[model samples]
Target: MRRIWFALFGGLFGAVGVAFLGAFRADALADPTSLATFSLWLGASTLYVLGGLDASIGDFDWYQLVGLGNVCLGLQMVARAAMTLADGTGETEPLLATFGGVVGGLTLAYIGLDWFRGGRHFDLSTFEESPTADPE
Candidate 1:
């Protein structure tokens, strides 16, 4: 029980910290707005994966696997930010964006393959796509 609490809080805090770090790094990127966009997309994806992991109630499963992959991607972005800062306005955009695009692109490919192979659906969620919403 205590371990569950630790994992829950640890995961929550870890994700939040990573996202916050990304937010703080936005200004250092080649184009702050582009990094902002990346942060936004990554933030949404992080929240979604966290929600799934939370729903699983700390079980070790696919949700955790997805969350782990997300962590990998987030670390890369953070590393890019650090590199950009270190370079101090050198030709960092291409390298940073290329790395992000490659990793994110491959992630999307894996996700698409898994989805087509009957993987988890982010859609059909009772939380998001509630059937009882008032027709507006």
Candidate 2:
């Protein structure tokens, strides 16, 4: 069951990556957005594969994979922001994108680092009840 879920997740990311790559190829020099999208999706696909392996084999550190994903996502966002600014449309949306991209990227990168250091902010085990807990 877990394997199936992981396969589906990885496949989804891989498909998106392929689509973005195709889009980029169709007009390689004109669109930077597609390139960034391809990169992030590729990273996501790789992360899921590594994560699945760690789940099954018990040697790999899944948190590190997650951290890598976060960093990739952050970089992608920053790239998008730069592309948007490069357009020079003189619009407010570009400013918003820039602000959001930088802040979100930094925040996610920090969270990723915390997870890499064994932080439990999103650890599922923390939600499990203790074996000795009294039945309510």
Candidate 2 lDDT over 42-116, as tens digits, reads 786677666545553345476566556666666667667777787788878779868898889778767666665
Query: Which one is best on TM-score?
Result: 2
Residue lDDT tens for model 1, 1-136: 2223324544565577577657877454556544554554455355445444444535544344444534444554554545556555657676677567657655654553443343575431222323465878
Look at candidate 1 and tell me the lDDT of residue 24. 74
Q: Give lDDT: candidate 2, residue 7.
A: 41
Q: Which stretches in model 2 have alpha-carbon errors above 4 Å?
A: 1-10, 24-37, 55-60, 120-136
lDDT of 2 at 123: 62
lDDT of each: 0.49, 0.64
At residue 103, candidate 1 shows an lDDT of 71
